[model samples]
Target: MACNGSYTVVIVPLQNSLYSSDALRFFHWLKKLRALEREKDSLWIGLQVLERTRFWYQHQLDQISQRNARVGTRELDEEEESWSCALRSSMQRVNGSLGSLLNNAYVCSAAPDEMDASDWCLRWTNAVLTQEVSQKNDRISILEFEKEILLQQRDGIHYF
Candidate 1:
């Protein structure tokens, strides 16, 4: 995420299941704001991102219900397992990042005079982005481990 030559925004890998084109556009817009040193604009965009994230979650849940109704309560096959894992990881990442943003917003609101507004906004945005990247990395590691376990299980079944 190199944005214009001013700064690099490290973002989490976009989960295909959750992030729509509009969401991605908003993220890029936020990055552009940061690049231009428009911290206030970035903060407002970040709040919109949070709202979009909530809607994404609700949409995902509704889709899941519809899928389950169509498929019944059968055990998930490998593809479904992979999709479910990715969805769960994305949901967790979104929740954690949103919570961090809300907490930072509260702290900033409670003591507006304690720090420069631009500085606070920049810091909060950076913190949220950092947490999202960390969570995505963790999810990747977990998914890799699960893959290894599944491969081993398949290999064992072949031998038996």
Candidate 2:
């Protein structure tokens, strides 16, 4: 007899056609194998999520760096310098946290039997994604405010 879900069972002839204790043990082992296969699949999925998140963070960092380079070296006012410092610090923290998450995912994938580790990976990924979304919303809001200010200025100039 063969079982599905990545398990194969072989039954050898034992006298006439009759059930045996050995067959029961094989069935139990097959069930256990299937459970392990499911766990392995979950672990694989967590690893893939971590890899994608890492790639996205890296790409964002690259974009920020390029933008900064284009801005060139101009003397920043105190307020601008403070804002720049805060943004740099935030980016560093994000990068460090992402690295830690990737490391945890790698370790968890190595030991798929650790259900707790897999759960932690899922939670961490969710938190990181939420934070990224919030940051993007803030950037969009800031851009919109700037656009409104520019439009108001144009209107005032045309009215003069």
Candidate 3:
């Protein structure tokens, strides 16, 4: 008995070829390095955002402290009053968005019996701003550490 069949033949590259394997490993290493670089860039951007936020908080804190200092037993002159009013208006805008820290809102609700409403509000706002600044500082530190680690990893891959 005789059997008739058609067979198709195709040639494929050897899986264990040294150059192909080396090229594959090189591409993989490049991909890892690129990922590490992107992570480092993101961390840098985060640090910058934290820095800007901290600066804004510091500016607000300074304004609040200045107002606290300027509030005294003696009444202000017209010029001083105008400046104080401007500062107060600016601070009010800040507080307005933060759930109205002034105008007898949260501060008055939680204030001690002896504390005046405005005084309590300023103190409360100052405390909150201070905490925000500290938290931003902590986050900046953490991002910096991560960026440093990412750099080291990227360098290792590059040298490998």
Candidate 4:
């Protein structure tokens, strides 16, 4: 009997699962916000880049979801594995470039339901675009900052 014979071992860390969930939530929220941003009353639409962006972001969301499903279910095909690995790497790389506060590990002070994590994630995304980050560099906080900017901007510009 060769001791080297492989034994099946499945290990799924809670953190990895949470991270994937966060990624999905973030992407989903981003999709909706992009839609809202294209209503001729939002910034991206005001810039006239919403159509191209909606297409681009839709593609990204699909890609990320597919990859996450494969990885989460351990059904990753060669192509899916490649894509999943690439997306994870890209996320990690982009994540590293961002302030740590913007990483996916942030915890909300209240329950996840108390505040919409999806919306929160969008805020960090906007902050990252603005090249700003919270003191701790948490991604959620970064998004919060972005949300603040948008609110202020909206309030300043909106006649109501």
Candidate 5:
């Protein structure tokens, strides 16, 4: 669902399957992956990359502006130097995390294209977008797993 949400805006099969029990397990897997992503985020590594990019680019622009030499130059004329720099540097910072974001580019900007990652993100996002999606799956799984027991009680029959 995560990748589906990010990659396919028009709706896809993966998006529809997020309601299944197996898909829910995939959702749980995604939760673990997101937890790790949160831990890394807590380290401020992402922030550092952003700040590094922002600070450096502005510094470069400032130097250029003060020199009166960068005037009218393509690099100088463009605004949001920090943004451009941030995008590039953030990609570099999360170089190894490509799989985490599913390499969707639209989801987390840091995810890779690995199968596990794509699976996790889709499941994670599915869980996030709708609680009922998960609750329904959970209810179904419990019923399925305990179907025989439930049937015995309801039918007043004893097991061999």
Candidate 6:
């Protein structure tokens, strides 16, 4: 499976049963896909707006910084320079994280063309449940290991 821009593409071998059993059901599925596409486009537009706003705010900040630099003493200028460097670095990190989060938020499971909605849903649900159970088991194991270590420490202290 390959994915880009909030959509999943499933590549499967051609099969005899590739056609949908119910035309109306397929129509509804197509409608839902269109709705999702519109939502995705809206989200992209909102992100672009936010980017423009951020740029405008940064431009204003640069003007203020320049004004301060012109009036401030040498010592204050040095301090301000360092502070601005730190602030810019932090801002870049935050912006990078936000971009990553936004990109990742759109990813979702999608069914293959050959699979019906019900089968795809069931498969997805099972996969999620299996992952959850595995994680829970790992947590339980860690707790048990910690408990054993604590008990051993207590025994050693009593003997001492």
Task: Give the best candidate by lDDT.
Answer: 1
Q: lDDT at 146 for candidate 2? A: 63
Best by TM-score: 1
Candidates' TM-scores?
A: 0.49, 0.40, 0.34, 0.22, 0.26, 0.36
lDDT of 5 at 44: 61
Q: How do the residues 53-122 of candidate 2 rate in per-residue lDDT, one tens digit apiece? A: 7897798689768768867676445545555565677668767977887788655544333435466557
lDDT of 1 by residue, 23-118 (tens): 777676665555445544455666777788778878988988888897766766776677688769767876786688678875554323323546
Q: Please list all clashing residue pairs in model 2, or write none if there are none.
A: none
TM-score for candidate 2, residues paired by index: 0.40
Answer with 4 or 5, whichever has the higher lDDT: 5
TM-score of 6: 0.36
lDDT of each: 0.69, 0.65, 0.58, 0.53, 0.55, 0.63
Q: Candidate 4: which pairs clash?
A: 100-137, 101-137, 101-138, 101-139, 102-137, 102-138, 102-139, 123-143, 124-143
Worst 10 residues of 4 by lDDT: 1-10
Residue 30's lDDT in candidate 1: 64
Ranking by lDDT: 1, 2, 6, 3, 5, 4
Local error of candidate 1 at 76, Å?
2.5
Q: Rank the candidate models, highest TM-score first.
A: 1, 2, 6, 3, 5, 4
Model 3, position 141, has a per-residue lDDT of 60
TM-score of 3: 0.34
Which of 3 and 6 is the better model by lDDT?
6
Worst 10 residues of 6 by lDDT: 108-117
